[model samples]
Target: MGDGALSGWERSSTARVIAPARPRKLAKVPFVELADGRLQGVVSSGSDIGRVYVSSVTAGEFAYACSTNNNRPCGGARGSYCNHIAAMVKEAVLQYGAERVARYLKCDLADAEPDAASLTRAMLATRPPAGDSKAAATVFSRFLRHLAYLEFDPATAPLPEMQWFPPTRAVA
Candidate 1:
Protein backbone atom coordinates (compact mmCIF):
# COMPACT_ATOMS: atom_id res chain seq x y z
CA MET A 1 0.00 0.00 0.00
CA GLY A 2 3.02 2.26 -0.12
CA ASP A 3 2.30 3.51 -3.63
CA GLY A 4 -1.53 3.78 -3.78
CA ALA A 5 -1.93 3.22 -7.54
CA LEU A 6 -3.70 0.28 -9.19
CA SER A 7 -1.48 -1.77 -11.53
CA GLY A 8 -2.44 -2.34 -15.21
CA TRP A 9 -3.67 -5.87 -14.39
CA GLU A 10 -6.00 -4.51 -11.67
CA ARG A 11 -7.35 -1.81 -14.03
CA SER A 12 -7.93 -4.40 -16.80
CA SER A 13 -10.68 -6.15 -14.79
CA THR A 14 -12.68 -2.93 -14.59
CA ALA A 15 -11.89 -1.77 -18.16
CA ARG A 16 -14.93 -1.56 -20.43
CA VAL A 17 -15.19 -4.30 -23.05
CA ILE A 18 -15.90 -2.83 -26.47
CA ALA A 19 -18.85 -4.23 -28.39
CA PRO A 20 -18.45 -5.86 -31.82
CA ALA A 21 -18.93 -3.68 -34.89
CA ARG A 22 -22.18 -5.53 -35.72
CA PRO A 23 -24.26 -8.63 -35.09
CA ARG A 24 -22.75 -11.77 -36.67
CA LYS A 25 -25.18 -14.42 -37.87
CA LEU A 26 -22.96 -17.51 -38.08
CA ALA A 27 -25.36 -19.55 -40.20
CA LYS A 28 -23.86 -20.04 -43.63
CA VAL A 29 -20.31 -19.57 -42.37
CA PRO A 30 -19.48 -21.37 -39.13
CA PHE A 31 -16.15 -19.63 -38.47
CA VAL A 32 -14.64 -16.34 -39.58
CA GLU A 33 -12.00 -14.55 -37.58
CA LEU A 34 -8.95 -12.30 -37.68
CA ALA A 35 -6.12 -14.24 -36.14
CA ASP A 36 -2.52 -15.44 -36.64
CA GLY A 37 -1.72 -12.28 -38.62
CA ARG A 38 -4.40 -13.06 -41.17
CA LEU A 39 -8.12 -13.03 -41.94
CA GLN A 40 -9.22 -16.65 -42.15
CA GLY A 41 -11.95 -19.23 -41.54
CA VAL A 42 -13.88 -22.18 -42.90
CA VAL A 43 -16.61 -21.36 -45.41
CA SER A 44 -19.36 -23.72 -46.60
CA SER A 45 -19.21 -25.08 -50.11
CA GLY A 46 -21.90 -23.48 -52.26
CA SER A 47 -22.45 -26.60 -54.40
CA ASP A 48 -21.94 -29.34 -51.86
CA ILE A 49 -23.50 -28.77 -48.45
CA GLY A 50 -21.34 -31.51 -47.02
CA ARG A 51 -18.12 -29.81 -48.01
CA VAL A 52 -16.38 -26.84 -46.40
CA TYR A 53 -13.45 -24.78 -47.69
CA VAL A 54 -10.63 -23.30 -45.65
CA SER A 55 -9.69 -19.80 -46.84
CA SER A 56 -7.34 -17.04 -45.71
CA VAL A 57 -5.69 -13.76 -46.69
CA THR A 58 -2.43 -12.79 -45.07
CA ALA A 59 -2.04 -9.28 -43.74
CA GLY A 60 0.08 -6.75 -45.75
CA GLU A 61 1.09 -9.41 -48.31
CA PHE A 62 -2.51 -10.37 -49.14
CA ALA A 63 -1.30 -13.85 -50.04
CA TYR A 64 -4.63 -15.66 -50.37
CA ALA A 65 -5.41 -19.37 -50.21
CA CYS A 66 -8.42 -21.71 -50.37
CA SER A 67 -8.86 -25.48 -50.22
CA THR A 68 -11.24 -28.22 -49.18
CA ASN A 69 -11.36 -30.05 -45.84
CA ASN A 70 -9.09 -32.72 -47.30
CA ASN A 71 -6.56 -30.23 -48.75
CA ARG A 72 -7.72 -30.12 -52.38
CA PRO A 73 -6.83 -26.75 -53.82
CA CYS A 74 -9.83 -24.63 -54.75
CA GLY A 75 -10.18 -24.55 -58.54
CA GLY A 76 -11.28 -20.95 -58.61
CA ALA A 77 -8.36 -19.74 -56.50
CA ARG A 78 -5.67 -20.51 -59.06
CA GLY A 79 -4.70 -16.97 -60.08
CA SER A 80 -7.23 -14.77 -58.32
CA TYR A 81 -9.39 -14.82 -55.23
CA CYS A 82 -11.99 -17.60 -55.47
CA ASN A 83 -15.68 -17.68 -54.60
CA HIS A 84 -14.99 -19.33 -51.24
CA ILE A 85 -12.46 -16.65 -50.43
CA ALA A 86 -15.01 -14.05 -51.54
CA ALA A 87 -17.68 -15.48 -49.25
CA MET A 88 -15.31 -15.53 -46.28
CA VAL A 89 -14.29 -11.94 -46.93
CA LYS A 90 -17.93 -10.95 -47.23
CA GLU A 91 -18.73 -12.60 -43.92
CA ALA A 92 -15.74 -10.93 -42.28
CA VAL A 93 -16.92 -7.48 -43.38
CA LEU A 94 -20.34 -8.26 -41.99
CA GLN A 95 -18.90 -9.38 -38.67
CA TYR A 96 -16.08 -6.83 -38.33
CA GLY A 97 -17.19 -4.07 -40.75
CA ALA A 98 -15.42 -2.94 -43.93
CA GLU A 99 -13.12 -0.49 -42.17
CA ARG A 100 -11.81 -3.00 -39.66
CA VAL A 101 -11.52 -5.84 -42.17
CA ALA A 102 -9.83 -3.56 -44.67
CA ARG A 103 -7.38 -2.40 -42.05
CA TYR A 104 -6.68 -6.02 -41.14
CA LEU A 105 -5.67 -6.95 -44.69
CA LYS A 106 -3.86 -3.64 -44.97
CA CYS A 107 -5.95 -2.53 -47.93
CA ASP A 108 -5.88 1.14 -48.81
CA LEU A 109 -9.46 2.35 -48.85
CA ALA A 110 -10.93 4.97 -51.18
CA ASP A 111 -14.55 4.92 -50.05
CA ALA A 112 -16.17 6.62 -47.07
CA GLU A 113 -18.34 3.56 -46.23
CA PRO A 114 -16.71 0.60 -47.89
CA ASP A 115 -18.41 -2.80 -48.06
CA ALA A 116 -17.30 -6.37 -48.79
CA ALA A 117 -17.08 -6.08 -52.57
CA SER A 118 -15.08 -2.87 -52.49
CA LEU A 119 -12.76 -4.21 -49.84
CA THR A 120 -12.04 -7.37 -51.84
CA ARG A 121 -11.26 -5.33 -54.92
CA ALA A 122 -8.81 -3.21 -52.97
CA MET A 123 -6.93 -6.30 -51.77
CA LEU A 124 -6.76 -7.77 -55.26
CA ALA A 125 -5.36 -4.56 -56.65
CA THR A 126 -2.25 -5.16 -54.59
CA ARG A 127 -1.19 -7.85 -57.11
CA PRO A 128 0.14 -10.40 -54.61
CA PRO A 129 3.12 -12.15 -56.16
CA ALA A 130 1.77 -15.50 -55.11
CA GLY A 131 -1.11 -17.23 -53.32
CA ASP A 132 -0.08 -19.01 -50.14
CA SER A 133 -1.84 -22.37 -50.46
CA LYS A 134 0.13 -23.50 -47.43
CA ALA A 135 -2.08 -21.33 -45.25
CA ALA A 136 -5.14 -23.47 -46.06
CA ALA A 137 -3.91 -26.36 -43.93
CA THR A 138 -3.27 -24.15 -40.94
CA VAL A 139 -6.65 -22.45 -41.27
CA PHE A 140 -8.47 -25.78 -41.56
CA SER A 141 -6.74 -27.20 -38.49
CA ARG A 142 -7.71 -24.18 -36.43
CA PHE A 143 -11.31 -24.49 -37.65
CA LEU A 144 -11.37 -28.13 -36.61
CA ARG A 145 -10.06 -27.23 -33.16
CA HIS A 146 -12.85 -24.70 -32.70
CA LEU A 147 -15.45 -27.22 -33.87
CA ALA A 148 -14.25 -29.65 -31.20
CA TYR A 149 -15.37 -27.20 -28.53
CA LEU A 150 -18.96 -27.30 -29.80
CA GLU A 151 -19.30 -30.96 -28.82
CA PHE A 152 -18.83 -30.07 -25.16
CA ASP A 153 -21.76 -29.30 -22.85
CA PRO A 154 -22.65 -25.64 -22.51
CA ALA A 155 -21.30 -23.82 -19.46
CA THR A 156 -21.40 -20.29 -17.99
CA ALA A 157 -17.71 -20.39 -17.20
CA PRO A 158 -15.53 -19.44 -20.17
CA LEU A 159 -12.44 -21.53 -20.83
CA PRO A 160 -9.13 -19.90 -21.71
CA GLU A 161 -9.27 -21.03 -25.34
CA MET A 162 -12.83 -19.68 -25.73
CA GLN A 163 -11.64 -16.25 -24.69
CA TRP A 164 -9.57 -15.91 -27.90
CA PHE A 165 -12.52 -14.38 -29.74
CA PRO A 166 -13.26 -10.66 -29.54
CA PRO A 167 -15.83 -9.64 -26.92
CA THR A 168 -19.38 -8.95 -28.10
CA ARG A 169 -22.12 -6.76 -26.64
CA ALA A 170 -23.38 -9.55 -24.36
CA VAL A 171 -19.92 -10.00 -22.88
CA ALA A 172 -19.35 -6.29 -22.49
Candidate 2:
Protein backbone atom coordinates (compact mmCIF):
# COMPACT_ATOMS: atom_id res chain seq x y z
CA MET A 1 0.00 0.00 0.00
CA GLY A 2 1.14 3.51 -0.71
CA ASP A 3 1.83 5.96 2.10
CA GLY A 4 -1.36 7.83 1.21
CA ALA A 5 -3.60 4.79 1.21
CA LEU A 6 -6.02 3.95 4.01
CA SER A 7 -7.75 0.71 4.96
CA GLY A 8 -11.26 1.03 6.31
CA TRP A 9 -12.40 -0.56 9.54
CA GLU A 10 -14.86 -3.41 9.68
CA ARG A 11 -18.43 -2.35 9.04
CA SER A 12 -19.65 -4.22 12.10
CA SER A 13 -16.60 -3.78 14.32
CA THR A 14 -13.84 -1.29 15.10
CA ALA A 15 -11.14 -3.52 13.65
CA ARG A 16 -9.12 -1.87 10.89
CA VAL A 17 -8.65 -3.50 7.52
CA ILE A 18 -6.01 -6.24 7.77
CA ALA A 19 -5.72 -6.89 4.05
CA PRO A 20 -3.62 -4.94 1.57
CA ALA A 21 -4.85 -1.38 1.81
CA ARG A 22 -4.87 0.59 -1.42
CA PRO A 23 -6.02 4.04 -2.51
CA ARG A 24 -8.89 4.04 -4.97
CA LYS A 25 -8.44 5.95 -8.22
CA LEU A 26 -11.89 6.05 -9.79
CA ALA A 27 -11.53 8.70 -12.41
CA LYS A 28 -13.51 6.97 -15.13
CA VAL A 29 -16.37 5.82 -12.97
CA PRO A 30 -19.54 7.63 -13.96
CA PHE A 31 -22.00 8.63 -11.27
CA VAL A 32 -25.71 9.38 -11.41
CA GLU A 33 -27.22 11.94 -9.09
CA LEU A 34 -30.00 10.43 -7.07
CA ALA A 35 -33.24 12.18 -6.16
CA ASP A 36 -31.88 13.03 -2.74
CA GLY A 37 -28.83 14.75 -4.24
CA ARG A 38 -26.51 11.79 -3.75
CA LEU A 39 -24.12 10.40 -6.34
CA GLN A 40 -24.49 6.68 -6.80
CA GLY A 41 -22.35 4.15 -8.67
CA VAL A 42 -21.04 0.61 -8.61
CA VAL A 43 -17.37 -0.12 -8.00
CA SER A 44 -16.65 -3.08 -10.22
CA SER A 45 -14.27 -5.66 -8.74
CA GLY A 46 -15.07 -9.13 -9.98
CA SER A 47 -17.05 -10.90 -7.22
CA ASP A 48 -15.86 -8.65 -4.43
CA ILE A 49 -17.58 -5.54 -5.67
CA GLY A 50 -19.60 -2.89 -3.88
CA ARG A 51 -21.81 0.15 -4.33
CA VAL A 52 -20.64 3.72 -3.76
CA TYR A 53 -22.96 6.44 -2.54
CA VAL A 54 -21.98 10.03 -1.87
CA SER A 55 -24.06 12.96 -0.76
CA SER A 56 -23.48 16.62 -0.11
CA VAL A 57 -23.98 16.79 3.65
CA THR A 58 -23.92 20.56 3.43
CA ALA A 59 -22.05 22.97 1.21
CA GLY A 60 -18.46 21.74 1.00
CA GLU A 61 -19.11 18.84 3.37
CA PHE A 62 -19.88 15.42 1.96
CA ALA A 63 -21.05 12.08 3.29
CA TYR A 64 -20.34 8.64 1.87
CA ALA A 65 -22.08 5.30 2.09
CA CYS A 66 -20.64 2.11 0.72
CA SER A 67 -21.37 -1.59 0.73
CA THR A 68 -17.73 -2.58 1.17
CA ASN A 69 -15.63 -2.37 4.30
CA ASN A 70 -12.19 -1.55 2.91
CA ASN A 71 -12.23 2.24 2.75
CA ARG A 72 -10.92 5.38 4.40
CA PRO A 73 -12.75 6.64 7.47
CA CYS A 74 -15.67 8.88 6.48
CA GLY A 75 -18.89 8.09 8.27
CA GLY A 76 -17.33 5.45 10.42
CA ALA A 77 -16.74 4.95 14.11
CA ARG A 78 -13.04 5.76 13.82
CA GLY A 79 -13.16 9.26 12.33
CA SER A 80 -15.15 11.85 10.45
CA TYR A 81 -12.64 12.10 7.63
CA CYS A 82 -11.75 9.23 5.32
CA ASN A 83 -10.28 8.49 1.90
CA HIS A 84 -13.40 6.74 0.62
CA ILE A 85 -15.43 9.90 0.97
CA ALA A 86 -12.53 11.90 -0.36
CA ALA A 87 -12.67 9.81 -3.54
CA MET A 88 -16.32 10.64 -3.95
CA VAL A 89 -15.61 14.33 -3.42
CA LYS A 90 -13.00 14.19 -6.14
CA GLU A 91 -15.55 12.58 -8.42
CA ALA A 92 -18.05 15.32 -7.72
CA VAL A 93 -15.45 17.95 -8.35
CA LEU A 94 -14.43 16.29 -11.59
CA GLN A 95 -17.99 15.88 -12.77
CA TYR A 96 -19.43 19.20 -11.61
CA GLY A 97 -16.31 21.23 -11.03
CA ALA A 98 -15.22 22.74 -7.72
CA GLU A 99 -17.37 25.83 -8.15
CA ARG A 100 -20.56 23.83 -8.52
CA VAL A 101 -19.63 21.54 -5.66
CA ALA A 102 -18.87 24.49 -3.42
CA ARG A 103 -22.06 26.25 -4.43
CA TYR A 104 -24.10 23.18 -3.65
CA LEU A 105 -22.42 22.62 -0.32
CA LYS A 106 -22.35 26.35 0.62
CA CYS A 107 -18.58 26.58 1.19
CA ASP A 108 -15.39 26.89 -0.75
CA LEU A 109 -14.61 23.80 -2.82
CA ALA A 110 -10.93 24.47 -2.31
CA ASP A 111 -11.52 23.56 1.32
CA ALA A 112 -13.36 20.36 0.47
CA GLU A 113 -10.48 17.88 0.61
CA PRO A 114 -11.62 16.22 3.87
CA ASP A 115 -9.43 17.88 6.47
CA ALA A 116 -11.74 17.79 9.46
CA ALA A 117 -9.97 20.56 11.38
CA SER A 118 -9.94 23.07 8.57
CA LEU A 119 -13.43 22.06 7.64
CA THR A 120 -14.60 22.69 11.18
CA ARG A 121 -12.94 26.08 11.36
CA ALA A 122 -14.25 27.08 7.97
CA MET A 123 -17.72 25.97 9.00
CA LEU A 124 -17.65 27.90 12.25
CA ALA A 125 -16.07 30.91 10.62
CA THR A 126 -18.89 31.11 8.14
CA ARG A 127 -21.16 32.02 10.95
CA PRO A 128 -21.99 35.70 11.34
CA PRO A 129 -19.21 36.55 13.74
CA ALA A 130 -20.42 36.81 17.32
CA GLY A 131 -22.30 40.10 17.65
CA ASP A 132 -23.59 40.68 14.14
CA SER A 133 -27.22 40.26 14.89
CA LYS A 134 -28.26 41.39 11.44
CA ALA A 135 -26.17 38.93 9.48
CA ALA A 136 -26.84 36.28 12.08
CA ALA A 137 -30.57 36.74 11.70
CA THR A 138 -30.30 36.27 7.97
CA VAL A 139 -28.28 33.04 8.21
CA PHE A 140 -29.36 31.90 11.64
CA SER A 141 -32.26 29.68 10.70
CA ARG A 142 -30.66 27.81 7.83
CA PHE A 143 -27.08 27.57 9.05
CA LEU A 144 -27.82 27.10 12.73
CA ARG A 145 -30.46 24.46 12.15
CA HIS A 146 -28.16 22.48 9.89
CA LEU A 147 -25.30 22.97 12.30
CA ALA A 148 -27.47 21.75 15.11
CA TYR A 149 -28.35 18.63 13.20
CA LEU A 150 -24.71 17.94 12.45
CA GLU A 151 -23.79 18.44 16.08
CA PHE A 152 -26.54 16.09 17.15
CA ASP A 153 -25.25 13.30 14.97
CA PRO A 154 -21.71 13.83 13.78
CA ALA A 155 -20.49 12.34 10.50
CA THR A 156 -18.91 9.51 12.48
CA ALA A 157 -22.34 8.09 13.16
CA PRO A 158 -22.62 4.76 11.40
CA LEU A 159 -24.73 4.74 8.31
CA PRO A 160 -26.68 1.51 7.97
CA GLU A 161 -25.55 0.93 4.36
CA MET A 162 -21.71 0.92 4.71
CA GLN A 163 -18.90 2.67 2.66
CA TRP A 164 -15.84 2.04 0.35
CA PHE A 165 -14.35 2.48 -3.18
CA PRO A 166 -11.41 0.61 -4.70
CA PRO A 167 -8.75 2.32 -6.75
CA THR A 168 -9.31 2.08 -10.48
CA ARG A 169 -5.63 2.55 -11.24
CA ALA A 170 -2.93 1.60 -8.82
CA VAL A 171 -0.62 4.46 -7.99
CA ALA A 172 3.03 3.87 -7.32
Candidate 3:
Protein backbone atom coordinates (compact mmCIF):
# COMPACT_ATOMS: atom_id res chain seq x y z
CA MET A 1 0.00 0.00 0.00
CA GLY A 2 2.91 2.40 0.60
CA ASP A 3 4.44 2.29 -2.95
CA GLY A 4 1.96 0.39 -5.14
CA ALA A 5 -0.85 3.00 -5.05
CA LEU A 6 1.47 5.96 -5.73
CA SER A 7 3.50 4.10 -8.37
CA GLY A 8 0.34 3.33 -10.43
CA TRP A 9 -0.40 7.10 -10.67
CA GLU A 10 3.07 8.11 -11.94
CA ARG A 11 2.97 10.13 -15.22
CA SER A 12 4.78 8.63 -18.23
CA SER A 13 7.29 11.00 -19.91
CA THR A 14 6.34 11.06 -23.65
CA ALA A 15 6.16 13.64 -26.47
CA ARG A 16 2.98 15.70 -26.66
CA VAL A 17 0.66 15.12 -29.64
CA ILE A 18 0.10 17.97 -32.07
CA ALA A 19 -2.61 18.58 -34.68
CA PRO A 20 -1.75 19.03 -38.39
CA ALA A 21 -1.69 22.47 -39.92
CA ARG A 22 -4.62 23.65 -42.05
CA PRO A 23 -4.02 24.22 -45.78
CA ARG A 24 -3.73 27.79 -47.01
CA LYS A 25 -6.48 29.31 -49.13
CA LEU A 26 -5.58 30.04 -52.74
CA ALA A 27 -4.99 33.64 -53.82
CA LYS A 28 -6.65 35.48 -56.69
CA VAL A 29 -4.19 36.14 -59.49
CA PRO A 30 -4.10 37.05 -63.18
CA PHE A 31 -2.58 34.12 -65.09
CA VAL A 32 -3.49 33.68 -68.77
CA GLU A 33 -4.64 35.37 -72.00
CA LEU A 34 -7.00 34.30 -74.78
CA ALA A 35 -6.57 34.51 -78.54
CA ASP A 36 -9.04 37.40 -78.78
CA GLY A 37 -6.80 39.39 -76.40
CA ARG A 38 -8.84 38.74 -73.27
CA LEU A 39 -6.82 38.52 -70.08
CA GLN A 40 -7.77 35.75 -67.66
CA GLY A 41 -7.56 35.94 -63.87
CA VAL A 42 -8.27 33.29 -61.27
CA VAL A 43 -10.08 34.10 -58.02
CA SER A 44 -10.18 31.51 -55.31
CA SER A 45 -11.89 31.33 -51.95
CA GLY A 46 -10.83 28.13 -50.30
CA SER A 47 -11.65 25.42 -52.91
CA ASP A 48 -14.21 27.39 -54.92
CA ILE A 49 -12.65 29.39 -57.76
CA GLY A 50 -13.63 31.32 -60.90
CA ARG A 51 -12.02 33.16 -63.80
CA VAL A 52 -12.67 36.50 -65.52
CA TYR A 53 -11.50 37.88 -68.86
CA VAL A 54 -11.50 41.48 -70.11
CA SER A 55 -11.18 42.51 -73.74
CA SER A 56 -12.43 44.98 -76.34
CA VAL A 57 -14.00 43.60 -79.49
CA THR A 58 -14.64 46.99 -81.13
CA ALA A 59 -13.25 50.47 -80.89
CA GLY A 60 -15.58 51.57 -78.11
CA GLU A 61 -17.01 48.31 -76.82
CA PHE A 62 -15.42 46.44 -73.94
CA ALA A 63 -16.49 42.93 -72.99
CA TYR A 64 -15.89 40.75 -69.96
CA ALA A 65 -16.00 37.02 -69.40
CA CYS A 66 -18.87 36.47 -67.00
CA SER A 67 -18.73 32.70 -67.23
CA THR A 68 -16.27 30.10 -65.97
CA ASN A 69 -15.40 28.58 -69.35
CA ASN A 70 -14.58 29.89 -72.86
CA ASN A 71 -16.03 27.06 -74.93
CA ARG A 72 -19.07 29.00 -76.18
CA PRO A 73 -19.81 32.36 -77.83
CA CYS A 74 -21.02 35.18 -75.59
CA GLY A 75 -23.56 37.31 -77.48
CA GLY A 76 -24.86 35.81 -80.73
CA ALA A 77 -21.97 35.50 -83.15
CA ARG A 78 -19.88 37.60 -80.78
CA GLY A 79 -17.20 35.86 -78.78
CA SER A 80 -17.81 35.33 -75.09
CA TYR A 81 -15.80 35.34 -71.92
CA CYS A 82 -14.51 32.01 -70.74
CA ASN A 83 -12.85 31.23 -67.41
CA HIS A 84 -10.21 33.87 -68.12
CA ILE A 85 -12.52 36.88 -68.12
CA ALA A 86 -12.07 38.17 -64.57
CA ALA A 87 -8.30 38.01 -64.62
CA MET A 88 -8.23 39.83 -67.95
CA VAL A 89 -10.42 42.60 -66.60
CA LYS A 90 -8.26 43.05 -63.53
CA GLU A 91 -5.09 43.20 -65.64
CA ALA A 92 -6.68 45.63 -68.11
CA VAL A 93 -7.74 47.94 -65.32
CA LEU A 94 -4.18 47.87 -64.04
CA GLN A 95 -2.53 48.33 -67.44
CA TYR A 96 -4.93 50.70 -69.21
CA GLY A 97 -6.46 52.22 -66.09
CA ALA A 98 -10.12 51.85 -65.13
CA GLU A 99 -11.16 55.13 -66.72
CA ARG A 100 -9.83 54.27 -70.16
CA VAL A 101 -11.27 50.75 -70.18
CA ALA A 102 -14.61 51.97 -68.91
CA ARG A 103 -14.75 54.53 -71.72
CA TYR A 104 -13.82 51.86 -74.23
CA LEU A 105 -16.55 49.57 -72.85
CA LYS A 106 -19.06 52.45 -72.70
CA CYS A 107 -19.66 51.66 -69.04
CA ASP A 108 -19.65 53.98 -66.05
CA LEU A 109 -16.58 53.29 -63.99
CA ALA A 110 -18.18 55.07 -61.04
CA ASP A 111 -20.89 52.38 -60.80
CA ALA A 112 -18.51 49.49 -61.17
CA GLU A 113 -19.06 48.08 -57.71
CA PRO A 114 -19.11 44.28 -57.92
CA ASP A 115 -22.30 44.14 -55.87
CA ALA A 116 -24.82 41.38 -56.58
CA ALA A 117 -27.94 43.53 -56.74
CA SER A 118 -26.45 45.90 -59.31
CA LEU A 119 -25.12 43.06 -61.41
CA THR A 120 -28.49 41.31 -61.34
CA ARG A 121 -30.25 44.41 -62.60
CA ALA A 122 -27.74 44.81 -65.43
CA MET A 123 -28.14 41.19 -66.50
CA LEU A 124 -31.92 41.32 -66.44
CA ALA A 125 -31.91 44.55 -68.45
CA THR A 126 -29.78 43.07 -71.24
CA ARG A 127 -31.80 41.36 -73.99
CA PRO A 128 -30.43 39.27 -76.79
CA PRO A 129 -30.87 40.66 -80.31
CA ALA A 130 -33.72 39.50 -82.57
CA GLY A 131 -33.57 35.99 -84.12
CA ASP A 132 -32.78 34.30 -80.84
CA SER A 133 -35.92 32.73 -79.36
CA LYS A 134 -37.60 34.41 -76.45
CA ALA A 135 -37.19 31.31 -74.32
CA ALA A 136 -33.46 31.13 -75.01
CA ALA A 137 -33.03 34.80 -74.28
CA THR A 138 -35.00 34.49 -71.08
CA VAL A 139 -32.87 31.56 -69.99
CA PHE A 140 -29.64 33.43 -70.58
CA SER A 141 -30.97 36.49 -68.79
CA ARG A 142 -32.06 34.38 -65.85
CA PHE A 143 -28.67 32.69 -65.73
CA LEU A 144 -26.90 35.98 -65.11
CA ARG A 145 -29.52 37.10 -62.65
CA HIS A 146 -29.13 33.88 -60.74
CA LEU A 147 -25.36 34.27 -60.69
CA ALA A 148 -25.68 37.75 -59.23
CA TYR A 149 -28.14 36.59 -56.63
CA LEU A 150 -25.91 33.69 -55.69
CA GLU A 151 -22.92 35.96 -55.27
CA PHE A 152 -24.83 38.35 -53.09
CA ASP A 153 -26.88 36.00 -50.94
CA PRO A 154 -26.19 32.32 -51.21
CA ALA A 155 -28.30 31.55 -48.15
CA THR A 156 -31.55 32.80 -49.72
CA ALA A 157 -30.97 32.86 -53.47
CA PRO A 158 -33.68 31.12 -55.50
CA LEU A 159 -32.93 28.04 -57.52
CA PRO A 160 -31.91 28.65 -61.14
CA GLU A 161 -34.84 28.33 -63.55
CA MET A 162 -34.77 25.25 -65.73
CA GLN A 163 -36.04 24.94 -69.32
CA TRP A 164 -37.54 21.79 -70.76
CA PHE A 165 -38.25 21.33 -74.47
CA PRO A 166 -40.74 18.69 -75.56
CA PRO A 167 -39.13 15.64 -77.08
CA THR A 168 -39.40 15.50 -80.89
CA ARG A 169 -41.32 12.51 -82.34
CA ALA A 170 -39.33 10.42 -84.84
CA VAL A 171 -40.87 9.76 -88.22
CA ALA A 172 -42.10 6.14 -88.65
Better candidate number, 2 or 3, judged by lDDT:
2
TM-score of 3: 0.26
How many residue pairs clash in each candidate at the backbone level?
A: 0, 7, 14
Cα lDDT tens digits, model 2, 1-172, are 4686664532335342222222344533334222234333322333434533222233333433443323322233123423443444556545544444455555652535644344433444554221211221222233235447646645776675554533223211
The runs of at least 3 residues in candidate 1 whose Cα sits more than 4 Å from the true structure, single-residue gaps closed, are: 1-12, 16-18, 155-172
Q: List per-prediction Cα lDDT, in the order shown.
A: 0.80, 0.38, 0.34
Clash total of candidate 1? 0
Q: Pick the candidate with the highest lDDT.
A: 1
RMSD of 1: 5.0
Error of 1 at 82 (Å): 0.7
**Residue by residue across 25-121, what tens digits does model 1's lDDT show?**
7767789889988999898887898899888888898888888888888888888898888888999888877777887788887764588888888
For model 2, give the 10-residue run with minimal summed lDDT.
128-137
Ranking of models by TM-score: 1, 2, 3
